[model samples]
Target: MTASDRIWQAQLRAHWAVLSARRDTAGVATSGLGILVGDEAEILAGVDARGDHHLLVPAGGGALVVEDSQAAYIRIQRCVLTIGGRGRTFVDIVCHRADLSELFDDVISSMLTELATDSREQPAVVCKRVLDEWRELLRRRGGLLGEDALRGLFGELVVLERILAASDTYDLSVWHGPDREPHDFRLLGGDLEVKTLGMAGSMVRVHGIEQLEPPDKGDLHLIVVRLVADHDGLALPDLVERIRPKTNDRRAFAAALARAGYSETDAEHYRDRRFMIAQVAALPIGDDFPRIAPSSLVDTLPDEVSALSYNLDLSLLLPKALTDAAITPLFTKGTLS
Candidate 1:
């Protein structure tokens, strides 16, 4: 743990002592930092009362418990963060005793900073945002990829390499964020979504119907990266480290990594795996590309069929594939600018 963590832990201990001393009373105990810790979870009101920004974490739950998904941790009755008050004057962001990981410390520190600096947003809202961010970060670290970690990491690397090669302004921030983003990388002129396959597979999974659908005015291209497991190939950490120096803002790059679910704690696992890019194919989302857009299927499908997903065989898309020479220019600087 860092010095900051030690200080925060000390403060928490002091706060808990005060709370225990005043257990019989129903009032707020103001800390040296001016943070009010109420006796209960429902009545916290030192900050904004909008309720959207408020977060209540439980206190004294042994040790910090980090989990794979936000739902799993947040939804449980154990030390969890929740919005809205049940009539108590305080909501505690519980610090678990099992694992006081750096991530939790950072989260607590961030919430306190936000509370101290920004009075416009409700505390609940601030807490919610912080929890959500951490949850997403944890998801990226291990949840989303699950068993397909190598393939997913390779896909992201392919996109990152292309972006770095194409633009001097390339940053990891552009490559990772909310997975719901329509494309993998958002550039000046258009967006690029990258798909990767382990073997010489002809099919690629289209996550959602909107994945292949381009923005109304800009360009959207799909890049298929075929990879083969190579013992001597580059590890995920090596690729990340190599690109880290190229980023304009290191803080943003780190935030982007957290947002994408990549954590330093799990870096060792990825370093053990290696892969080499074998083939690259690029296809522009045009009239000729094989895809199903909601606009096109809205009238044909049943009204009840709101969400749909399917796979497309690349063998069928061979005729539309951009030649290697043609695809190279797409990654060149100013191609999107």
Candidate 2:
């Protein structure tokens, strides 16, 4: 088969594997969340080809290898990845671990926020102010408000943008949407979710800010995020759920089964698939306000990453900086299911 065929097959298989996992995990922990798992979770021991014990190492050029167990193994492309793991806990080694990276990123960000010429005019402060204000106001206008008109008014691909926009504290500082490649978004360089909830007069809550993922990009997946409310008195998750996918695509799996040549009757045995995001950010908008990187999201990144890659993803939460001063309006609301 050709590479494209291989990708298609892999995609099908990946969907199958994910659906299988989702049947049980309740979405908190899964293969894609970067948690390197094995077929034998309860009982398995031994290392890979290397003398070091089996464990999750930073497989890619820039992931956190959460060396959880010597018996755990990481993979690449599709198969299990072979790598060297020194003595220590597996979680500590990987770059994807959030606690370490996020704390570090936050400290650095706080320092930078303080060092800026002045707080109000500083890019970071401006970003926080804008994001906080917008999210806050929306939280106030409680009770099933219309999302379409609200989002367009606040400016976002999802109605959530307007829900957040009502915040006096948070404004849509940056609204990033997903692009063709680089399938996901993260806080700073971390891949998870970053978003706000709340309304004016109360306070805004930001989440997925310090969440962790396995750093794994294929097959099994895990999605994690944090949620904060601006003030009090509103079911945020309920409102947000109105938009997220009900579940992973199960038909995608049946198709895979059929492709593998299974009988239609057997194919129907597969459970429906599911997907979820802790939070979503907006795409890059022009930089009227300074677009500071949420580097504070990570603590100990791999030895390799540079400062430049953090605010790079054209996310729906974060805006892209434009060179031209003129602002041209464009359609930026709703989601692609």
Q: Using TM-score as the measure, which candidate wins? A: 1
TM-score between model 1 and native: 0.55
Write model 1 residue lDDT over 1-337, tens digit each, in one string.
2344345545655554554454433333333444542222232211122111112433221333332233422321222323344332233454332122233445665566555553654555556676676555544544534446557656776667666766675555567324558677776666777778766687888876788887766788888888788899987767767765465544355566655666544566677678887878788887667788755565666767766778888887755687576776666531332
Q: Candidate 1: where are CA atoms >4 Å away?
A: 1-144, 176-178, 298-303, 323-325, 332-337
Q: Among all windows of ten consecutive residues in candidate 1, which has the lowest summed lDDT? A: 45-54
Tens digit per residue, CA lDDT, model 2, 178-243: 221122222222232322322211122222322222233211111112133323322323232332
Candidate 2 yields a Cα-based lDDT of 0.25
lDDT of 2 at 148: 27
Cα-based TM-score, every candidate: 0.55, 0.18
Model 1: per-residue Cα lDDT at residue 318: 57
